[model samples]
Target: MNSRFTGRLHLPGEDGYEQARIGRVFNARRPGRRPAAVLEAVCEQDVVEGVRLAAERGWQVAVRSGGHSWAAWSVRDEALLIDLAGLHELSYDPETEIVTATPSVKGGDELNPYLGRFGRFFNGGHCPSVGIGGFLLQGGQGWNARGWGWAAENITAIDVVTADGELVRADADTNSDLFWAARGAGPGFFGIVTRFHLRTRPLPKHLAHTVHAYPLDLFDEVMTWLHGIHHTVSDLVEIVAVTQTPPGEREAVLLVTGVSMTDTPEQAAQALAPLHANPYADRALFRIEAQPTTLAEQLHNQRTANPEGHRYLVDNAWLTGTAQDVVPAMRKAFTDHPTPQTFTIWFSMAPLRELPDMAFSMQSEIYSATYVVYGDESKDAEYRAWLDEAMADLQPVTAGQYLGDSDFTNRQLRFMGDEQWARLRAIRAERDPKGLFAGYLTADEPPTNTNHWER
Candidate 1:
């Protein structure tokens, strides 16, 4: 088994076993579960071999692309952890305008930067360090998702190692079931995706933004207005409202922001004008409208907001209701903060776009997520309690949850439409009938894709 691996392998109780286990995990709140062995795959063949080895050893296979999952889904007890950090392959074709990349490729940090050289872009994760694998699999809510659509919609094909240890390509024309399931399966995906072939778009020539900061005391009034008008804003603008203390600030404040993806200042100004028309704009603490910006600058801000080496407790919901009901229900999440770095975001996907037939089928006009950032291990219980209460406040208006920021070990919500969920389970049963893959990490034996309260 050792000779079959081209890359390093670490077994339990070894010198580097612990580091190989969770060294790459972004969340400081690590899991106690441990894999039987960690295989750092240096190439695609290694992934194939790893899966075969797992089957021979009677071990389930768990995979880690960038190790950014908040729940650390890769480190399953007694499973073979295939770490793809070393399989960093990226290339582009001019004729096709498509980029082929490995699962471990960082979306914002590597993929976009490489695409930018060719005057192109692929909507990746907001956090620069997030890997494209889990992000795309979970229905990537990338930049301007309200307009450009979910990033997973751009997947042209995938090279996967199936549970039977066979390497195959999946696309609309071939292995279609696997392709359909890959787009939205997230950690429960039945196969190991080695490479993603993604379609690219021309990079917008001009980028601009609008921002309005207000006191948190006016959360209800400001949020109510936003909820009513966000759907009317042009899809070219990515709208977000958040409450957080700035790097040097002493307290949290509400900030309504919009970034326009357009080719000219005029178009940017026109697209962002609706957000700037806030009735409370006159009372804002500060305002910046149609100011020029860059994608690098935007990604930098995201990196700052979600910094590394910190304990994080994150949760999100797809919200639907009248402004009167939704705004008041979200007050606790948007206004309260247990730590200085704690923040909550109200992301807009208003004027919802219809999704193509795929496994990733659950969303609404409004998306809200809370990130409780702190470094105190001792206060984990305290912060978790606060987050539970905050999310509970949204129960009435919460339609479902996004898999990207969700932790089923803590809470479960409907993440996929009923039909899609049923189809996904059937595919998993047929594809991985022997249970070669370690599926969703949850407290329950099999995840009941129903909201906890409803169940």
Candidate 2:
């Protein structure tokens, strides 16, 4: 690691150094490298002051909240990282169903207590520790996305510390452009978002989730079955397609993890049964097991922490139809499962049916999918090489990656499309003119140039 940093710096020897060096990937991609200095912000003023200091000293700055970006962009080399991870504060009101939280509050249990205080729940990605800033900014297209809209759609307002350190509120009327861009523009684009006001609603009557795993040999049949199910399910059901390498398996497995909010798990499972009764779904595997649990509990199960120090490679794209041609291509690659490594291939078409197309991209709203690869650091070279190769190999079939599972790359352009990309870039040009908070550039960069750093 390079040891040269010019500023009022914080080195490895400092007490606060370790805190800022933490990676967001939990058990993988531990950046291990530390930034030159860690700007600990307690309040909005602290954010303004810290960013102002970084700007004055000409330092490249990255904002840190839950630190869960796939690339660990939060803790990059030579950065005067703004550690907002410590600024935990929240307030939720029953009457208004409006919940306000600091960028670092993590918006799960910290938020559940408040929402539970009112017997209400706000729609968010099930990851308990995922910060509202990154998730919402990236167009949080998951479980509740089809129901409540993306995180950006649910957030009423945001308290942002801009490039030049001015604290301001952005919402529908005042900063409409920023509001639009923030919804799905991916995080760290406009500036450091300090606080957020999320719109909460009542919990559904029943939260039914189940995982159905199928053999790798029947991957094609499974894909077809999934496509058929997605084509028929009602608007309220949320389904996820995870094409991953199961434990002790050489060929990749198709795991359909679904959560339905119908009257009963039986009803939900029955609604999905037609899609499951095919040869692919019946390829000698256990059936979908349903359970009843609170939305908060469901989220906790999804993002539980584990021991650190593995690495990951993930890319995404949304295939609209059944993707008849894509199934076979994946099978050939499935056999060469990289060691200490696994992949998560998911499919969904719920969110598109739920939100207005004019505002955010509907790419993630349909039969969307992601390719995830995970392994220990020892195989970083082998896995990373495979990731790049596989993505290049798979690009002809689909485009448009999901932000929830994407990394920093020029490959991001396909999933969101050109029209939406132009709008987001325009918003970035206007609000964040100096481009201070410019860490998570889409894997697929658009036609324009984004060269100027924090100025």
Candidate topping lDDT = 1
Q: 65-126 in candidate 1: lDDT tens per residue?
A: 98999999999999999999999999999999999999999999999999999999999999
lDDT scores for all predictions?
0.95, 0.62
TM-score of model 1 vs. true structure: 0.99
Off by over 4 Å in 2: 1-15, 23-27, 32-36, 244-252, 263-270, 279-282, 289-297, 304-309, 332-336, 354-375, 409-412, 441-455
Clashes per model (N, Cα, C within 3 A) = 0, 19
Poorest lDDT segment (10 consecutive residues) of candidate 2: 446-455
For 164-205, candidate 2 gives per-residue lDDT tens digits of 789888888876666666666665466788888888777667
Number of clashes in model 1? 0
Candidate 1, 1: how far from true, in Å? 2.1
